[model samples]
Target chain A: MREQGRGDRLTALLRRGPLLAVLVLYTLYTTLPFLWVGAMSLRTTAEISADHYGLPSPAHWGKFRAAWVDSNFAGYFWNSTVVVVSAVAIVTVLGAMAAHALARYRFPGNRLIYFVLFSSIIFPPQIVLLSLFQILVNYDLYNTRTGLVLVYVSLQLPLTVFILEAFFARIPQDLFEAARIDGYTDFQIFLRIVVPVGMPAIVTTVILNFVHLWNEYLFAVVLVSDEDLRTLPVGIQRFMGDYFQDIGMIATGVMIAVIPVIVVYAFFSEKLIQGMTAGAVK
Target chain B: MSAPADAARLPAAAAPRRWWPAARRGERDPGAPSWLTLMAFLAPALLLYAGLTAYPVVRTFADSLYDLENMDAPRFVGLAHFVAIWSDETFLRAIRNTLVWSFVAPFLDVATGLLLALCLYAGVPFARFLRIAWFTPVLLSYVVVSILWLWIYNYDWGALNLALRALGLDGWARAWLGESSTALAALMVTHAWKWAGFNMVVCLAALHALPSEVLEAAELDHCGWAAKLRHIIIPMMRPTLLNLYILAFIGKMKVFDLVWIMTQGGPMWSTETVSTYVYKRAFAWNTFDLGYPSAIAVVWFIIVLAAAAVLHLAFRQREKLEY
Candidate 1:
């Protein structure tokens, strides 16, 4: 009987073995494109074309350097940085203030304001694409970094305000009353009290807004026509148009665009995940 | 700054009892503040959002009435552009593609996400590691993700073809993104890859928050995996699924980057979505007909609104489930 039980256990193990192997294989299949891109980036066009199935040679090492210059990646990198950082900073400060008020205070039209912000999420971006472009051109803000920053801030404000408001609303009310008793002005209370307690939420908002702004392509493409003002996405288009056959360099350029996002994720992966998923679960 | 003082100056009785009855019961209401406090916090965001988002949206409607490129005296061509789009093959194709893109991609992505969440929830070995690995694609910009996949789908020396050849299935390999028939679907699959992690993360959070006892009870009742998921888990996850569906729908409708990167809505405009088609009309094709694009955009907006309304009504009666 013991031998029979052992045989049954062996069969179970055998059944599970293939399932486990398949899962591992599926995971690899999912990630193969990423790994392949990295490998292809390191290979020269000749190396990629010559073997068709062989490993990349050492001759492709300079492709990254060539992509950097040929793609005008430095300009793209700078433009993206300027627009994203500035938009994140501005939205963070403004969003915090709005969130604090909406959460803590009772005022006429407060519900109306909340609905306005919330409903902004429903406005399809394409609807505003033409008009925003026209308005920016009329103001002579089109094709400028400031114009892109404004669009980013507008695009990002609703989400940031929504998340931050939810966070600020959770702060213990006694803390505010205590600060009030201590004669701390509202600004002082916000600056010294709410800001400190809300650092986690703020950080999350900053990371999210940064990612959104950095990845923005529509506004960048529509508004900025000059090659000099192009952000990373637009810059990549220029690179692709200019070097349609240089797959190695185009891959290298793409890999460069992906690095910052990965680095940011590595540092704030936890908070970013929590913040994003929080809305869905609730 | 002076607003708080002004608020304080109001007669004490008029200000109402500021003491919290909830505090006496060891519960606190966080929304206890004077009007001044509210203004100090809320005004800045309202102003910015109004200036940037609300204003531009209203302006879009107004701009649709005029022909800006012609510098023609701001003539109002009410509904003419809308009428014209019905005859425009590009616009019609874009509408069809956008509908397919939004509906199909979201369904696949959400379903994939739900499956992944279930796998992780079952405590599959290396589950945590799988979560991180799957999420790497989400971190990549659409620019990079599209480029990487385009190579993998390349005809001659592509990864997919290479894999097929390795498995002695060379006859099955094809130019995934090059052909018009498969290009849209290929793009949709790439989109699913990029966002499946996002939806999975969302669903996983909800799944984790579900009452474990309920699941256990279902299991004890001889409920198999499929039955338990269908009867217990999915019913509980209805609201989340609806919200994510709306979000995914809107996102797919407005998709540009991956399509732009992979095929540029090309190979004879086969995959030209509404947003991309509008973009082409206004910019690439330089049609000088802003009204037409705006009309298409307005229709897109209406479809999104319809989706949101339907979802909202469907989920309206659900009990708020807290994590």
Candidate 2:
């Protein structure tokens, strides 16, 4: 019996050994492209496709500066920043309010409204891009920051509300009852108490929305015609033409888009994981 | 300092009213103030949603019904554009390409991700470092990943070909993205490389939540590794696995950036997806059969809706198991 038990233990270890090795190897494989991109960003155009796969010798740091200035990436970066910030702010506020009302009040058409909003989360943006471009053209908001911000806010509202509602429902109702008895109005209670308590969810919503709006290419490419109005994703696409190539600059543009998200994730990874898992275990 | 104590003191020794309009509690009536507060929070979002998202979706269907670009006047085309797209060869090809994309990519990604997650979760050394490394690609913009992969797929100077030749597999080092048969497959693999970490992280989270006792029991029973996983681990992880599968399916159907960057429906439109085909028709081809792509979009929307509904029903019926 003891011999059989030992054999089983040995077999288990053997089975797990390859899996552990393969997983670590695959993880390195996954990070390789990102490291390559960052390396390319620092390499000159000439050495980008050269024999060296690891590092560039002279370390051409000017590509980042060149990509920033020569490509007018500064303007694109600012454009993305404004649109994303405004969209995230609006979505966070509106979504919180909608979630509060949905979770707290018993109103007619409440379930129906919830269902509609939830369904909207699944609606693909491609279905509406054509009409959206036309409408923006008609309203004279086409190619403008305000137009892009508006589109982003509308697109993200459903998801914001969905996650926020789930978070709100978990907050104890006794807190609300006590606030009401303290002579605080419903609006005040939500603004003062609920909002403060729900800061983590709001932060997660902001970071995710920020990442999304920064990297949005489809709308920026299609709706905006003027070069000055381009966002980073669209701006980077300009590097690729029929044949003439500059891989380093393109990689630099990608790095610019990437750094912000990495920084935010580094600071707020806990909130991101909470938002993603949505208290699944809890 | 002592904020919780102060808040705790506020509600005691008061007769709780069943219902109080603002004045019954110690505060002044916030009649107009409350309304303004609600509107303040709601107006910007409502205006944006109504004007941009909701209006555009409605207008897409409306635009599909009209022929508006003619010099003379706009005419009602009804569903002719939609009908025409059914027979449109490029549209058909795009549909076929998207079908392959949605079906194949998601399965491969989910399978690889699950395997990787199981491996990483085995209490291996440097496991946390491996987790971070694997998740790195998901942080980059799709444009960057696409660009890098494009270079990697180059015929002569690409790293992939170079590596193949170094391994003495010179005959196998063909232009991966140049051929019609392999172009879509290459793009799929690139996407899998980018997103597999995301799925792995998700699955790993679920794995981390499982109870240790079940595995211990299997071990005590002298069950070998395969039986333990099949009988204990896999059955326990069904719900999370299902959710990831559906999410992957929906995501793959909307695959755009990688395909656009790598091939651009290239060689001869062999790699075209519904999204690229839609863009081409609306902007590139300029036939303004806006209805055709809209119909395709509508179909895509319906598939998503159906999938969500099925998933919802499944979740409702699933018995909750304790960790």
Top candidate, metric lDDT: 1
Question: How displaced is residue A121 in candidate 1, in Å?
Answer: 1.3
True contacts kept of each: 0.49, 0.38
In candidate 2, which residue pairs clash? none
Tens-place lDDT digits, model 1, residues A83-129: 88998999899888887776666656666776678777667788878
Query: What is the docking quality class of candidate 2?
Result: acceptable
Off by over 4 Å in 2: A1-17, A49-54, A242-244, A273-282, B1-44, B70-72, B307-323
The number of clashing residue pairs in model 2 is 0
Per-candidate TM-score against the hidden true structure: 0.89, 0.87
Model 1: colliding residue pairs: none
Error of 1 at B18 (Å): 31
The second chain of candidate 2 has a TM-score of 0.82
